[model samples]
Target: MIALAMVDNFPSSPGIYLMKSAEGSILYIGKARNLKKRVRQYVLGSGDSRLHIRFMVQLVESVEYIVTDTEKEALILENTLIKQHHPKYNINLRDDKTYFSLRMDMKEPYPRLTLVRKVPSDGARYFGPYASATSAKEVLKQLYKVFPLRHYPLATCMARKRPCLYYQIKQCSAPCCGKITAAEYATLAEGAALFLEGKNTEIARIYRAKMNLASQDMRYEDAARYRDLLRAIEVTVERQKMVARGGDSDVFGLYRQGDQVQMAVLHVRGGALTGSRTFLFDWEMETEEGLASFLNEYYDMDTPIPPQILTPLPIPEPAALEELLSEKSGRKVTIAVPQRGPKLEMVKLAEKNAQTAAEERLAKESSSATLLSELADKLHLPAPPRRIECYDISNIQGEMAVGSRVVFIEGKADKSLYRRYRIKGVLQSDDFAMMREVLSRRFRAESDEEKPDLIVVDGGLGQLSVLNAVLEELEVEGVEAAGLAKSRTFRDMESPEISKSDERVFRPGRKNAISLRQNSAPLLLLARIRDEAHRFAVTYHKAVRSKVMVTSELEGVPGIAGKRKKALLVHFGSLKAVKEATVEQLSAAPGMTAKAAKALWEHLHEKQQA
Candidate 1:
């Protein structure tokens, strides 16, 4: 539904549009203060009335735009084109274990707090968007029960000579034995940034004026350690949930059943509710532009931005996304929409916890679509593979061979379509020519990846006849493979019993092996995709046998050949970091040469001067 003479020469300023689809792809990405009155509100459909944007504006076909000289540079180029074109009708929010936070680095000397997950522009103070990594290590285990701070790192507590069981329990101020003072660990890192900025009554009135100045200097054990730091800051602010009596907000909650969306937020902070999260997904558009592109990718500067934001719906350019979340959460943020009291009953308890997190994620995606249709009816296959892929291989008898693969989709594990390979022209212990050179270099690669709808292979019936001779020598058709095996045991020689066997499977024209039933959910999902492709090929064949034992000590040194022995094992990633480097870090590695890094640093210290 594009052509209104293709947005009649667009430019009514502000920008970022995109739409596309009909071969060109990007089916949605938005942002605009005007771009010709928002592509004339989705080409006269008045922008978004959602039937998921009128079936994505009848498959768009073209709308492009860009412009950007402010509407906050078209809200950061529509969040960098919805994170580089993940634009399938917007709202991804897939990244999970929600932004951890906490950090501290007030130019260090003794400042700790820690927990992270990306928040670096390093001036450092941070706090949290925390709702995981066990709520930012349960708020750094209650800010180490009253901020004595320094829980390690000042170069590992200045290589600690002593003082660690968190300074024998007063939860650390050992500052590695100097027991505090860097202005008392910078006043316990300003009372752990005012108890993670919920400002627990100005840090319990500065620990009640340091427990009444350590009880007027009589110092009864520093006035009972400031009366146990105001009773552990009033028992962690009496375990949260107040929901009011103060401010720092963040409510937002919307739920949808069609186009499956969820949303939820809650948080509240000083006014308490303390945590809620929810996001769920499948959105197609207009819940005020998916809660305004989820509050501009959930307030990015690694998340925590609550001066206020309580939406139910008002979005589009809400004052230029409150000036881009008040310039990346430095503060003054607001987005409200209330309409009654108790902030619309905490946005209807974040839309009843986003409709109980979208009916517990559609009953865990309808029990992973009935365990992928009972594993496509016990692997007779045709449909429920829902992108499987497995492989395996590893190597020790073959010396550093590799393999791996892994993936699984509808029934879960998708380590970003895992993969691995490396057995270069099978030189030895042939596990069927190293599983036919890792399944013919993963089905003769011309990669954009996504192909598998089932391929698993670990072993049995000679690894399903080397994956049916590498998919009948890569004429590779719609995939479907199987092999599995593992479960052996035996032992009975008269009264000393043992016996084991059940795992099996096999398939490709099955000449046997099918067993199953020992704890079957399709044999525990084909033994969890053959033990995650044998733990991703024995963690990449123990990192290629420790870089082939550091390329056999750079093939007995001299000029250290093979491209400076693979550029000093890819720049010193061990032979004990190239035998503790330095012949000027092996002549600054990459294909070395200060006379071959002083003959491989004098042949790696000539076997430590024998």
Candidate 2:
């Protein structure tokens, strides 16, 4: 405990303390009302008796503390330190994967508004880390209705010989087709930005003013359009009913017991509930500890930090959290524990939402457990399979062959843990060889760890044999592996509709296969597993095939590499034209080179003749 030795004779001061593991990985970072008392707790092992602490204790090779003037100062320092270090025990909000946001590129001559997962520092106004793709799309849809923003890219708009369908439908201003001036479009775009930023009332008022002017000038059609825009904007805001009673803030509440935790967040943008999101943290942790940990962990990640954060209970280091958040946000941050009023109401609402989410989650988990147990019964396994691994190989006649490994822990997909492997040892068109290679790599990795309960292969007995050989080579014992082979085919008849019983299961080391009765519990389970594997494999295979097709086309273009190829495809709908373009047309394409175009033209022409 280098930190302990340093603190043993040190004077009391409020600051941040970071505990590091033996390898110098941060276990946890914290602040205290009294540094001496807090430091002593760790030295003597007297902090909260939570699972996190126990786990932290195992990793803590040393302790460290920074002294500050007051607890508040310590709070601020702690937030900063925690964000920088991201101690393992903290509940990290920043760890959430980035969701798409609606961005309006404000600096462009004609701002291009679109959905983006990450907000770039290109002078664009971004409006979300929206809960879902659908919600973000809904917002964009509503915004377009209120403002004449073009959804299509500038290139597409410019390339169009005349006004497209969107222009006729009144969905776009069609500046690309010279339907609107730069200055006029700019005014409409600014209003759209304001609307997205939760200034709907002001935007509506501006539209109303424009409508009145148009009416007084006797421009009836223009007045009618502005009137409609104002009404649409108001209607959109009205649909978000909860926004009427709150301020711009976030409400957080947690429902946790043991390692199972559900944290729900309701985002109030411009005083309305824009959306709610629920997060499940499955790692073993204490309830209060997890809440605090999640807060620290989440906010500390490199995500956009909001100004106000409202929680049901006060965080362990509220002051520190606020300061740290303020620094990251580049504005003052308020971490409030509301006792009454809208804040309290918001927390209650959030807690209710959390409770509902938790219940729904528990129900799903229970259902999944039931399904797994039934599946085990159907498969005649010793017990319910805790870890079921599904394998799928994807490729078109063996080109760009890849295999995907999807793991289901108690029925639901653990996507973060899902893996993809490029078939390393096998050349093109060798499915069995590719399967063997993928399984060899996979089992070799798992050979040292506990074997999976079941290995599900998405093919016939040949696929099963590949897995069996890999397991035998690795000497991975006791794990049951099976293949869900395709259903029987009748020569003069159509392919038999594969029912649960139709799925033949080839057990490891067994030459004969058994078909479970369609109604049997085990049959249902096997069918589910087989279908899941098939779905995963097919989706992954299609993705690989698509990528290969795209790359093959780009390969013909002389100057095209990875990035430039992506830019070209993103700009154009297809690579066919890119393969068969004139030099002038190809040069006009985004990220296309004269040499690239000529090379592609020659290649396509040569191939066509050959």
Candidate 3:
């Protein structure tokens, strides 16, 4: 039936409504505190300007709604219908339906901790739809550290001769090795569930009690370990402080303009901000109208129902929506318009962040446009260079010295193409020698897989000279090159001050240099490329240095092979922790046995004797 006709038929009672497009696919799903009053707003036309609704009013092929006993029931039904239908105009809960959830399958003999992207129906407890894959893994890492719950697959847990790598890393308690009882593991799993469900206060109390018991039992070290876990939990909660308001309330803020719109959502549970997400959408409609349309569409999503939602605008069906949302949440939901208070402050903060995000995106676009225009003019090229490459060298007393290449497409940095080189044949911190060695090896291996139109070096006259010599020897041509130099210091007090902001550009075979005005487009472009190159180089150097600092028995102690390393790690958990462990403790580790642990301890102790 037509939308207006269906609206005429709607009863003045709680119900779930469905808006559909011409193709018989649902477009929007919503619950109304009063079906007749909510539906009448569409049919009677309260001078609403939403283009989507206007079109629907003109050609709404069909409309449907299900009556519910209460607004809460309608809310539940609306979310379910929205998930099932996935209408075109709905504010999607999970943008990429392929989302991740931390699953704890409590049904198994040895419960498993697995990462699942899709929800399953196998009676597993699921925890999240984390924003990104990396974020999901980060949560998993924190969960493991907090709980040390086993992550072994069902089959592996059933028939395991030894603990796996996770056990060696101390990330798991080795339940497969029978080191921990099933009942104790189950308790940990239950605690994890409560933690995920926003029950931190209860968990904190329990943890404190356990810590006290361990202390009373003369296990001072174990008590300290519990203290560390408590600190981690506090840090996690504090990191999420921005979203939480110490109350069970939802926050929604939007930044929108005619065709572009972004929404920020904060879900506060048990007085803690547990989740926050941002959503962006493009609608071929006006701004205010789009806000109204989006507001209606968003609340219909099938995520957990919050008791209250704070929004910037008064929605079209405010009373009906409040009632419907309240009913769905199984409580009285107050959809308040905060004039001034902490609530208002939160709303303003969200709006400001959203606006800032939008502005940054626009600024980057403008920067890219300017760079493309300037590069085309300066390089004497037919068009702007699409890809630019810059290089820098990093070292500490010539040990673990490395070179890095950073790429910029148009004007923005592209990290995926960043490459690092280990400096060979360069004995010390000689910038010139390092440049020659790094560049020669780089271009020598160029193929269909790698090449750039422009190359930049983070140096001055000497460094560029070395690079030019390498290019000439290699006979590589048609590529433009430049050197960016930092400002030099002056001795004379009366002379104009030399600022770090001052940068000089050097060109090949040129007598004079180019100096971009501190605030000019070219200066900004060059500085951006230089900073990115420095960042890339420093990151690579740190990685190499960290590896050098890490003392591994296999690499350090003689006669320690693959099997021994595995045994040490699996027995002692972590190398650093193992270093601090007593000889008795090390030997007691499962397969290590007393004799082997004693021998290892004596070998390590020989250093003190020397």
* Candidate 2 C-alpha lDDT tens digits along 435-550: 88888887775456556899988777888888888888988777888888767644434655543326577876577787677556666666666677667777877787888777
Candidate 3: list runs displaced more than 4 Å: 1-45, 49-99, 105-112, 117-125, 197-199, 215-228, 231-244, 247-249, 269-275, 282-307, 316-336, 361-610
Candidate 1 wrongly placed segments (more than 4 Å): 1-97, 100-126, 130-135, 142-205, 212-214, 217-222, 227-295, 298-302, 306-322, 327-330, 333-386, 389-412, 415-452, 455-485, 492-505, 512-610
> Best to worst by lDDT, what's the order?
1, 2, 3
Best by TM-score: 2
Question: How well is each residue in 1-610 modelled by candidate 3, as lDDT tens digits?
Answer: 3546656777888887776667777766666777778667766766456676677555556678889987656656766776677666554454533445678878877666677766544667776645567887887788888878877554334345678788888778788788778876786777787777677888788778879999999989768977887887777767764444555676778887655787777666666655567767765434544554555456554344556777776654466557665655466877766778878877787787677777777787787887777865764445666778899999998888999988988777787788899998988878678878888878884555456677889988777788788888988776678888877765556767653446788878775567566667766787789988998899999988876664444365544556776766665555654565677666665566676666677766675467
How accurate locally, in lDDT, is each candidate? 0.77, 0.73, 0.71
- The clash numbers for all candidates, in the given order, read 1, 20, 3
Give lDDT for model 1.
0.77
For each candidate in turn, the TM-score is: 0.33, 0.82, 0.49
Q: After superposition, how far is residue 364 of candidate 1 from its true place, in Å?
A: 29
Backbone clash tally (model 1)? 1
Give the Å shift of residue 18 in candidate 3: 9.4
